[model samples]
Target: MKAEGGTTCGNSTKNDSTEEVKNQYHYPLTLPNYTKAEGGTTWKDKEQVFDKAPKRIMANTRPAAELLLHLGLGDKIVGVGADFGAPDKTVEKEYSKLNILSDKYVGKEVVLGTNPDLVFGRGGLFDNSDGRVGTVDTLNEMGINTYVLESSVTGGTYTSIYKDIKNLGKIFNVQDKAENFIKELKGRQEFISTKLSSIKEEKTFAYLHITDPKELNVEPAHDETFFNDVFKMVKLDNVFKNETGEVSVETLINANPDVLIIPDWNTYDGSSANKMKEALYANPKLSSMKAIKNKQIYAVDFNYMFGYSYNAIDGMDILAKEMYPDLFK
Candidate 1:
């Protein structure tokens, strides 16, 4: 059968026999003389592959940190977002010396001063409505090519993150590094998938984002949230499957997941983790949930969950091991 772009990988309509057409003059072939060509002053000889590298790059999100690290071009960074949490100790120390965090979002003037060749970040960061620091149009007008990694628009996953890295590598002409990075991440994912597949009983889970003092937003596992992807990868059923987009406390109480994954507790103080547990346990309506009763509630770093990168792999491993020790062990 013909593929989406009218390209066939296997037997074509013209070549009905199972015999493979190894010539450049085949019916489906668009480019002629591609196979018969020899080393000469041809199109391939004159084709100019760009060796020019981007002098400076500005990252406006946390995921960019991983991509930049993988590229091993951290020195090219003229400015980084306040939220770019580098896990590498060497990079972190170098970044601290740069003292770029004090200004939060690097001003357009500061970025311009650095003369960045490219600006990479999530598209949402450019929104002026929610106090966005920069704009793609503004950067474009100033002759700076800006790439808003589209992986963040959908659910973040290891596949998506790898795609992002590959895309960046293509743009930066670092395809070799990108391929190696993807291979490593895929190996890790396969290892985790194999381990979890052995488990007979998969635990039900609910992930919540506590945005306010009294409000708990239940994140559905099958929706746009990346955490859902993590849970599904480990064969865990999301209790709030029916719910969509920031579920209410009533929904949380109704579904009552076997385990609740609390993301981002840095905003609270005074034994906030304990208090969150206590509050859930003390609540007459929610106290009966199996998760609360068994004290299975867990908190993870906000950066690990929210940021779209290999960090999610870390979060997945942590969650999987916590929820099912028998499988992960």
Candidate 2:
């Protein structure tokens, strides 16, 4: 079995995470309390499960679209959601690196215009309130199969990506592809763990989600299912380990973390991470923090880390290299 799509390599490692992955592979989805997103549904247990391959599918995010191609289900995909086939990018320019999907079909529209029988969202919350593709439940009720990537469930882990691929494979009747995909991902994780296993030092780290001039929504340790495994895998301390609840600028400054893992998403100055780095350096109050002073603040890619897709292996590798440059080199 061979994996279709994986990490966008940038001089990374190759190693065996098989044993470690087997030991810590399964991460349970206990569900989280959401303020804005959908709530009160037993998704892990009661959600709709697909029995056969869906035709005329809508891949809502780039990662979702990528997963379709990886599964060799590109032909089944009627609409490529999340701006992949937008007017600006031609099919050639959009998927130049993905040889498998080079000649496959792609849609320029985001929603209903394609009239899809199924919709795949990277996250759990997608209500009709947004007025784009309609809610998952609505689609499901209308006889259209819908699935929320397990990773998008708040409190999901790296295992969520594997679980999603596996579940999707079962749904699409392609179990072989899912198993191979997980194998490849574990290999990538092993690559990072083997290279940086010698380190015992634990640096206090925080994942700043939104970095506006006034405030930032930081993922505290209590609610960080994703980053906890990531930081632990690389042997780094999470700053918010002892605390929970919403994070503010004052809280971050007071904690004075050893490293700042800013997952930048906004599209400003090429990428928001660079923009965030600039903002932190210029801010008089934040400039004095330990992470800022030592220049240990790293602006990481959003989808690679927070995207909660198969790209998580790439996220893990990025963190390891950033945390231990000497070891990787």
Among all candidates shown, the one with the greatest lDDT: 2
lDDT of 2 by residue, 23-130 (tens): 243322222211222444344434564434567777766667777667767767766544422111222344333322222223223466667777776554355544
Model 1 segments beyond 4 Å from truth?
1-51, 84-99, 102-113, 200-202, 211-214, 219-225, 241-246, 266-275
The C-alpha local distance difference test score for the whole of candidate 2 amounts to: 0.62
lDDT of 1 by residue, 1-329 (tens): 32323446554655534223322222231111111012221111111122244658877754565467667656677766645332544346554544253224555565566667777765445543333435655565566666655444444454667777776666565577788988977887888888877676767888777644256667674544555565666777777766646677777777777788776455323236666766766767677788878988877666566565566776677767876788755
Model 2 bad stretches (over 4 Å): 1-44, 47-51, 84-110, 210-224, 241-244, 265-275
- lDDT of each candidate versus the true structure: 0.60, 0.62
Q: How many pairs collide in each candidate, listed in order?
A: 0, 1
